[model samples]
Target: MEEFKDQAMEQKAQNTETEQEMEANFSDMEAQMGCKEFHPGDVVKGIVVKVSSDEVLVDIGYKSEGIIPAFELAFTKVDPFALLKVGDEVRAEVIKEDREGNIVLSRKNALFEEKIDLLEKAFENGETVTATVIDVVKGGLLVDVGMRGFVPASHIERGFVKDLNDYLKKTLDFKIIELNRGARKVILSRKALLEAEYQGQKESFWSSIQEGEVRKGTVKRLTDFGAFVDIGGCDGLLHVSEMGWGKVAKPSDVVAINDVIDVYVLKVDREKEKVSLSLKQLGPNPWEIADKKYIVGEIYPGMVMRTAAFGAFIQLEPGLEGLAHISQLAKFRVNKVEDILKAGQEIPVKVLEIDMEKKRISLSVKDAVDLQKPESEAEPASEEPVKEIAAAVEETKEIQAEDETETTQTTEFVSGNEE
Candidate 1:
């Protein structure tokens, strides 16, 4: 009976041990719960899930999406459609949770909180930043920084810009002159940045520049007296009289805005920061070589450029002209200069005079015509041989004079109308 009982207990124990050898893995089965709760003054990164005209929906690892009101999208007037798009990553501040458990957020406030720190440092360090001109407003342009920044009309460029509309939709660099974080106001100036950069460049340019150096420049502005050319960082006056070898009636006649041109550096004043430039000096002066090209008592072909009452201007070459007096136009008398010589008429002229100091030349048409005549038409060698021979005898007789004999002397021109 005891053995039977032992066998039964052992069998029961064996049965209990063999009954179950089962184990289930619970490592992956442990599920995580509870999302992080956001409160006011919290900044979080979120992805834009939906962009709308009035609001934007962003997923910021919350139970519900964050709602950003249109006004909260930017400090300035903004079109959310243009500013934000679907699936854009955004950094925002949690303003509050509404009664319905919806999260209200502000992108503008978050950007303000972050960029203000940077802008303050930038202002203190005199650093620069790039900004986009959003719209033209009263007295100036509105730019998109972290918040709205004001740039006055006078701060748009180095020079005055008449039309403010030109700055719209343009990106420009600016320097922060005034930053009032308490008042939430920021005043910027592009001119300040330009002036600073130009000062450095101007100094460098002046160091390397010397008189008589030829340089390339762009025509920047035009005035009645001259055009202003931008060489590097400085503007030089290019007067109308120095624009060309010929005549330049107006500055615009010689240069246009944005034209790249070569110019001679006439003078420079580093202390005053003034530069004088000349365009005509790049070429040789036409009057300098006049002696080599023109000679007295010679004939040259010329065109009657223009006629005046006193004389007719005959152009022997480009920019070289001589005056032909009305008396020299023809052998006989002329009542009107134009009747004898017309403008644009080509004729041969004798060079009678050349004044190097005054740059004047005298030409004669009659002399030139006479030179073209046949040798057969030439006059006798001596028109009055007896007069010449008597003059020689008198000169040699000289006061054989008063002592030898008294002689009566008479002079004549030896012409048919002699007097």
Candidate 2:
């Protein structure tokens, strides 16, 4: 009985030892199988393990493998095989796991985080990066790098940006001006970057430019007297008179906003950094050909074009007009000039005098008519009329005397025949 009892005790002890060992093995398997605590939106590093036709498997230090979609692995410049191979390390984001399964991950979110990180570095270094303007709102715009960034409307351009839609999808190189994570504020400036670059380029361009260099420019802004042009980076004025060799009634007539044109450098002021440009220099001077075309004492057929307080203007050619001055309109005295002449009247005029330096011509209308000579030389005509009347009276007296003589002879002959 003692030997049997001893054997039972030894078996029970062996069973206990086996149970303990099994429990230890189960605990170790559970620890190895459990995934790490990875929250959604957390960026993490991973390694590519299996590249399949459908998907690429990544081990992100998690118990289960992470699958990246084939479409998500697309890269244009470098071959996908070159950018990603088996055992390649990469960064990714922790998207929530399949609730039914283990944790899931994304490469796009990781790329976004990387972009933001790069942007932060650029901000610290005062560097610029190109971004697309996604939306326009009141007072500002939404620019997109990886995440959306705010660009105040005031900072959209060198001055004011009227049409915000014009910037949409247009990538602009910009700099980060302000950023805050807690308040969720990010401000960007394209003009600030532009201004700095413009200053440098303008200084270099203006240094090499002189007062007589002709260049091509675009009309940026217009005013009553002139238009402003962006020559290189600085703005220069193209005055109304400089716009054309002919008369420009207003600056808008010759130049329109955003019109690309060529202009001559009229004057350069280095101290003020101001340049004066002329558009007329791009063409021949109309006045240079005026003297050769028109001469004094010559007649020109013209039409009344404009009525002024001083006179009616007559246009002989397209931009050249002569003033048929108030004093030269009629032969007789006139109370009002308009009473004798009206606008749009076709009239023959003779150029009495021309002043090329003053850009004026004196014209006359009355001098173009024909007039009769004076009657002071008619003394012989009066004498001839009186002598003809005296001759007629003398001939009448001779006729009467001859008729009386013939009647008396007839009576004497009749008396002799009767005896």
Candidate 3:
């Protein structure tokens, strides 16, 4: 019994020394953490111990856990449970000590200090930053670039945007155009970034583009004379005359805005920075085969496009036109071509001649009319001869009959006298 008591006393003494040493080590660690050095405006690093709906508790090695109210957690409204979790390491600024002796902390202030430095550096270096569109206010958009940033309506795009709501909840890249730390104002521009990209593309396009090459383009806008097409990064003019082989009354008839089409690069004036594009050149040229399609003396259906005092212009096909002179309009003398033929009149015309060298075609309406006559009307000479023969035969027969009648009368008279 005595030996057992002695062993118990030794075990108890050893346990007491171990507890004292552990307490002393904990005190030294608390000193190292500088818990006594905490003051308002001081930044401290800590680990998240608890997260609730209204607040977060962080262990900054203080006597008690530091309290971060939900409002002080972030610049925007956020759920504490979503923003923080137990054991998450975070940095916070000491706001004050509450009456309950709990250290008040702000994660928002700490983040602001850190983000301000980055924003300033980006502004000075002309670097781009990513941001989220938060709200669309009057004349501009509000974005969250670590803090609130303003994007003026004019700076939203290269062109005007009719609806700002389209950008809501969208993440886009932006350049810091203006920044005022004292005023807490940050102005950003998404257009600046886009413009830079466009300019770069334009330079590359100018260097590589060549005439006679085919390219795809989007119709940007339409004018009375032509359409402006965006080919890659640069705009080229698609003239109305080059739209098709046939005459185009208006550019809108050929293409509308925002239409994608294939275009042939006709000319590139580097000195003027102008490019001329053609849509018709991609297909076969109708004039090239006009001689084969149209033969002299052959009649073809044509439309009278327009008539002048001297002649009427007739369209045999989309790109092929022929001239019918006033004399050729009809067999009779024609003083005015318009009196005989009007615009939009459909008629058959005989191909008189095709001057391949001059690209001119001569047509005759009178020749077509004569060739189109009925077979009986066309054989007028033969019919006249037949009629003459018939009349002569009938006249001879009548003379013979009259002679017979005279002879008969004379015989009858002689016989009656003799009787």
Candidate 4:
């Protein structure tokens, strides 16, 4: 029994040795085939075991070592330090055979094929890819899309790009907008990626916001209606009505392009991603203090800005204007308001009335003139009726004298007739 058990163990050990030897022989055969079959333009798999100033050594199990020029290690720039490191496994194409019987390899060509594969997958799936801008060339920027790719300057942003060099050395996320592998043409868009992200982020931000938050923003554009401001990477409308408590003739009067401003949140609608902001709400209302500065019978100097048949309007400040009625144009002699007031003219007026809620101020130019003149001189003479009464009395007296003269002449004539 003991002899039989030892015999079984010996057989098992012999079987294990044979399997090991077979594996070793297979490995050698594979190595020999790899070395013998490799030729120029053929692809080979290897590990980067050594890096030198002029070449990189790749171990492909060949009898003669494979060598790659230092420039090929980087694929573009000749940076030996950045290109290859020990223990990095890479695929390369056989470029040539050196006189020393060593195989020369190229990593750049291998990388090109790999990039083509990745690009095909990305285009098929409509996926976003990230790239780094290597340099800014005429008409476009050279980018690395896992390999070298071209990004037209027009496709860099939503608007015109002023400085192309600003994008150099910058990694950007982009979409494969167009690709033609046969023609070796590819088009990438950074704007498309930004727009998609902007839409989603804007919706999410709008959903999270409520009333009563101060936001930092940049002025994107100006129009007659208002200015479109970029608020925290999203756009919001700052309507003319919400621009200020005082009047605003143009949006540029308050904000300029690329200006940074702090705005108070008025409303936000996530369904539309529409947000409203108020720059006026940041300060006290000027109209609230208007009543305190102006009151009935108070005279103040103002600038004339507009004129009408009923009144002449004066601007107290940049925005506030008050109307002076035609009846209050002057103390007495002025027949027309335009005669004394013209646009852009400076004038003094007295406040006759004020309605804060209505935002109306009734001003009197007559009162201002009266205050400047002597009271007696300001009082107009009452002449029409008095002159008429005096003329009537004189006419009565003349009629009575004529009647007496007629009576005396008649009496003298009768006495002469009787004699």
Candidate 5:
């Protein structure tokens, strides 16, 4: 019994020593954690313990939890409940100790530091980033690119943007135009990215386009002389002269804003990056039918559209016009074109000569008037005798009687043969 008690006491002492050693080791480890060494501006890694609407409690392996205010939780204002949850480990900056013995931490300051590092690498590599437009302020826009960034109005697009409100809630790709860690300012530009993309498309369009190839284009804008059409990648000039076969006094007369039209690629200057387009070239030329349709000595109807000092311009068709000299305005002499002819008057005109190459036709109004009737059709009333008129009428009656007698004889002979 005594031996058993001694062995039991020895075992109990050994167990107590082991327990004391463990406690000492645990205390040394807690001291080594150095929670007290954490000061303002020091970064600490912590796991989230509790999350509220406005604040987050984090366990930094310290005796007391660290409290992070909502305003200090992100690069911008944020709700702690939306960001942090229990058991989520995060890195934070220690601001100071509060009166409640809680360590004050700022997640935004820590996140700001991390984003600066990322931006430095991005700027060095010439990389592009995506961001959302948060608000439009004076002279520029505020965006979120993992941090608050300012994009000037001039940097929003290739041209000046009048309505900055259109960019609100729009997500766009941007190039980091300027970044400063010391100033804590980040500037972004969407225009730079668009320009780079257009440069590539312009090159491809220029190489693929061939003369005479038809392309669908949109009428982007109109000038006094032409319409600037956007044919996918580049703006092409569609001159008023090439709008159609008919005369167009102004570019707006042919097309309106945002009109879709098929245009022929007339010319391409790769060196200058210029394109010439034509809407008429896509259709058949009206001059092609002029030679076949217009014949010399043919009398056709034409409208007197306008009168010149020397002659009158008569329109035979939509694109075909001919000149009638003042001398041919009437059979008799006229002081002015208005004396015998008026605008919008339709009259028959004889084609005297056709110059298809020059797109000109010499028309004679007098000849058309003179060719009304031939001398063989009827003689003069005075010269015509009454006896000749009566003889002609009697001959017409005799011929009709002879035709009836022949018909009766033929019918009687056929009936007798059948009998």
Candidate 6:
């Protein structure tokens, strides 16, 4: 019985040494397998080991392979097999450890984090970022610039935008006007970039623009006094007075919005940053050859255009108007100019004087009528004949009335005597 106890003790010591050696070998194997401890929210890099429709398995130097769900592979729904394949590298964020001892990772979250860092840098540096417009929401547009970004309607263009749906699904450049990482809010402006570019063009335009230069322009808007035209990057005023050589009642009559036209640069005010443009100057000036076209003491057909307190304005032709003074409306005295001459009335007038320097022409309707008279009646009639004719007619009427009154008075006197 004693010999048996000694043999049993030796066997127990040998088994204990074998168990320690096995434990050391297991530790060495674990080290070889790269057993890294990962917790939730840890970012990791790995190579894609397996790609399936539902999930993508990545080797992240961990005991169990990292599992990325298909839904977590991107911000939007995507096919994992098409997006990733075996041996492709990827970055992911650790979400949690699953019950199967597998790591739950999110590739979308990792991409989002990286994009936020890049966007933050872009915002600080005033750099432009590209984004795809996804939806046209109320008051603005929703875009995906690696994340949800909003562009206000007012900041979408240099002017008012009537429709926001026109920008749907279109990719455009933007400047980050506001950013809040905590709230995950981002505000972008395409107008800011457009304005910056326009300002550069505007500076170049102002520097190179010269007076009397003809430029192609689009009518932007119309006001009571003029139309604002977009001549390249700058807006210039096309005044109503300069729209035509003839009278312009309204600016709309000359040019409509969006009409492309040629304009003459009349003047440039650099101090005020104002440009005066003209449309009529692109054509010939009728007043330049008025003296050659018209002669003094000659009769011409004219149409009454408008009347003033002083006289009536008659247009001999387009862009050529002369005033017929109230005293020269007719051969007879005129109480009111409108009584004799109406607007749009065609009449003949004689030019009495021409002042080419002042651009004034003195016209006479009475003189024209006198020239049209026969030579026998061409002599100037004296006022005495007119007064004598009126006086003699009044005397004859007075004598006939007096005779009737005397006959009635005599009849009354005779009737009284008989009584």
Looking at model 3, the pairs that clash are none
Residues 165-186, model 3: lDDT tens digits: 9999899999999999878889
TM-scores, in order shown?
Answer: 0.68, 0.64, 0.67, 0.60, 0.64, 0.61
Model 3 global lDDT (CA atoms, 0 to 1): 0.86
Off by over 4 Å in 2: 1-92, 95-109, 181-185, 303-311, 325-327, 331-334, 343-348, 357-359, 366-419
Off by over 4 Å in 5: 1-37, 44-66, 76-91, 205-209, 232-234, 256-260, 270-272, 291-306, 310-318, 324-355, 361-419
Error of 1 at 402 (Å): 68
Q: Tens digit of lDDT per residue, candidate 1, span 1-419?
A: 99999999999998776654321223222222114678899999999999988999998877788999999998777899999998889999999999998899999999999989999999999999889999899999999888889999999888888999988989989999999998889999999988888999888998988889999999999999999999997899999888876656798876899999998999989899899999889888877887776778866777788899888999877567899998887676655666556677666778899988999999997776531222232342232322432343354235334423432232233443474
Q: What is candidate 1's TM-score against the reference?
A: 0.68
Name the TM-score of candidate 4: 0.60
Off by over 4 Å in 1: 1-39, 45-53, 59-63, 75-89, 269-273, 291-309, 336-358, 365-419
Model 6: lowest-lDDT 10 consecutive positions:
370-379
- Between candidates 3 and 6, the one scoring higher on TM-score is 3
Judged by lDDT against the true structure, how good is candidate 6?
0.85
For candidate 4, write residues 165-228 as lDDT tens digits: 9999998888888888767667888888777877787767766777778888999988899988
lDDT of 3 at 46: 96
Best by lDDT: 3
Task: Name the runs in model 4 displaced over 4 angstroms.
Answer: 1-38, 42-92, 98-104, 113-128, 136-140, 152-155, 158-166, 176-187, 205-216, 232-234, 264-277, 326-349, 364-419
lDDT of all the models against the reference? Answer: 0.81, 0.73, 0.86, 0.77, 0.82, 0.85
Model 1: how large is the Cα RMSD against the reference? 18.5
- After superposition on all C-alphas, the RMSD of every candidate to the true structure, in Å, is 18.5, 23.6, 20.2, 22.8, 14.5, 20.7
Model 6, 130-191: lDDT tens digits are 99998888999999877789999999999999999999989999999999998878999999
Instruction: Judge candidate 4 at residue 130 and give its lDDT.
Output: 90
